[model samples]
Target: MKGPPMPAPLSRREFIATSAAAATLATIPVVHAGGSDLLRVGLIGCGRRGTGAATQALHADRNVRLVAMGDAFEDRLEESLATLLRDKEVADKVDVKKENRFVGFDACEKVLASGVDVVLLTTPPHFRPLHLEAAVKAGKHIFAEKPVAVDAPGVRSVLESCELARKKNLSVVSGLCLRYDWGFRETVKRLHDGAIGKIVALRANDYRGSNWGKARQKGWTDMEYQMRNWYNFTWLSGDFNVEQHVHFLDVCAWVMKDRYPTSAMGLGGRQARTGPEFGHIYDHFSVVYEYDDGTQLISNCRQQPGCKNNISGHVYGAKGH
Candidate 1:
């Protein structure tokens, strides 16, 4: 199947009007069916985010228990479990035993098959499509992190999984926290009420730093090194644009009535983040996305250190901003 193309440096416009997001939470309340008064939860990709997500879920409901955990690295899985078990807030809700902790690329599938009613897919974006597909097939409700896929093929897989989840009456909650922010919600609501009049121009920035990567260890192959420092690689992390700047991009899409841009032209480069340890991701990017009606959304993202930082969006309208 044909997929969305990477933004090429062309004077011509290119249409990419599909939704630039993953499946959001179901409007209907998600009901758990593991057992009476208990929600068996599993966590895959046991990283900082994975641990945090599991903690949040446990805190969200007393009946929820984290029963399984998995990660591509055993160290990651162990550290996450150790941290979660040490935390006072939701420590009691974690029930992952040695047998239930899996490691390797197929670890997520093991967690899904562990008879958990709910699964938190906090894996890297490259692994998300595969994990989601497995979780849905296993009849588990999902709590997935944002930037669900790294490429068009992965996105396609996620879309198919979302459809399958819907048919199976499963809930799919993404980690797009902006959607739940009251301030953003109110602003969007008022914009619809003509507070911003007609939104004629959109601008956003994701200027920040600390896109860090570890130096390769002495006894590691390229595969081992890249897996440990996935964030710096395009294949694993989709570069910073998709991995980090997707937040602003998704917000822009949301503000534009959840419709994607008709076309885009962009330029970006490695710049100061140019080193073997940092892998191959560009440190800065600037893209201008055009809608069907010719309105434009311009975006800029930079990850170099010492740069003045800002994470903000603006909607300029004919009447007001």
Candidate 2:
């Protein structure tokens, strides 16, 4: 006789809440826009990245206002709002009220329903697909962080949402900021115009020390703890390759005018990040991405202390270095 299959390790409470929230998400109608007066903005995931995005939005335009804020934790929301208000450029445009500062697993839903024109989704990668879908369904434009998804299923959802956003005339911009830099753009343009002839090989390296990993706080559930320290988890951050190193790899692809890698073979291991707080993510990876024409892209990333770092990308061709 076969024994019972092993159960998932997630907490029952977290599972029930997540399932219930997902089931009810379909009921949120695509409602009114922020109108033509002010470009009202709401921020989800009020962490360091979220605060930075909120400030940059205010500085980018004269007609924008930070109207609402939300986070999984109330303290984070408070800190984010404080930081936003403290910045000279952002303070004048800050208009979030006490009632509009939401916190919890359902905080994103509340922020989306608050009638904002745009939303900044700087949550962990695990929440990107969910938050993006919700933002699209709520009829709001989105500026989401990188590696839009942590898995293939989430990527499928994001691709579907992108099509829907197109139909709805909503803008969905990813925070792959390197693509927007003038210098990188100019170099890529020259490379495309035959400055780099007969491309031979490319290399992308994001070797760096440990990022912002945190030890578990007291009284937090496993799920809650993981969400807080998401960068350490593969399902949350997609490892460092997709989360951080995708930028350099994409630069190589852009220079070659190829949108994707045809094949990839790689291996990775968790070296110094062996503590429980580091979760299940690897500390280093070495992958070779092959194009259809046999060109291969070498990729590597390491997140361990006391190691030499290299956060650069290179393209090699017959005519140039």
Candidate 3:
């Protein structure tokens, strides 16, 4: 039996326009060329990464303003806005009003309807699919962070949203920065240009200490606590592999000419941080990915502290490594 039919290949315009880039909210040139004067941005998450993205967006262009902000918690939303206000360079561009400050689970929907041209989906991986669909439906450009989804179903949803965005001529850039880094881009280009010859095997590693986590406060419910400490739960963050190590995996795929692995077998478990506060995610993962061309990608990532950090990847080819 034959497999399912493939979609038509993306044209050069679609490829260039929809390709994920580093600058999330700095696409004012496109917006301006498309006959827009100002770029209004809405931030859906208020954590460190979200705040940083917002700051970058504000600094990217003078015609850009943060018109809306949303988060699951009011305090986080307030803190993010205050942080933006304190930034002297981008302070004047921060114009989020009181009514535009949305809090609670439905904050994303409200932000999308707040007369914004761009929306940053910086929430946890679990909420990404829902928020992205809403953004695309509202005809807003998107800057979704890495690990777009926590599970396969969410990934499918995100793909559908991206397709819709493409059809609408809207840009959807990802949080994957490796694609934008000049150094990495040049290196990958050389590798693809036969600098490494016929590549055979690859190795990637991301060994580091635990990321931030918070103890449950007094009045917070289980749901609230999980949302606050999202990184610890696989349902929220997709574990360290999807949440953090996706960069390395992406690098591996880029080296392989964008050919993803076919399958893999792996085992992971919590070693150092086994407390209940850490949730149910494993602290380490080791997997070997097998591609259709017989290439293998050995990947590993860990979150235990003081375990000799090593964050690098290498591709071995026939002519040279």
lDDT of 2 by residue, 132-187 (tens): 99999998877888889989999999999988887877767778777766678778
Per-residue alpha-carbon lDDT of model 3 for 1-321, expressed as tens digits? 243343444432343366343444444442332325677889999889899999988877667889999999999999999999999999998999999999999999999999998888899989999999999999888889988998999989999998888788788888988776667877888898999789999999999998777888899899999999999988999998999999989999888877888899998998898887888889999999999989999999999987899999998999988
**Per-model TM against the reference:** 0.89, 0.86, 0.91
Q: What is the lDDT of residue 229 in candidate 3?
A: 91
Q: Candidate 1 at 258: error in angstroms?
A: 0.9
Query: What lDDT does candidate 2 reach at residue 271?
Result: 82
The Cα local distance difference test for each model comes to 0.82, 0.80, 0.86
Residues 1-321, candidate 1, lDDT per residue (tens digit)? 243342333210111111222333222123443556577889998888888888887776556788999998999999999999899888988899899999998888788888898788887789899989998898888888988999999999999998988777777788988876667777877887888787898998999985788899998888989989999989999999999888888888888888888899999998788878899889999999999988899999999988899999989999988
The best-first sequence of candidates by TM-score reads 3, 1, 2
Off by over 4 Å in 3: 1-24, 27-36
Which ten contiguous residues of candidate 1 have the minimum total lDDT? 10-19
| Regions of model 1 farther than 4 Å from truth | 1-35
Whole-structure CA lDDT of model 1 = 0.82
Model 3 weakest lDDT span, ten residues long: 26-35
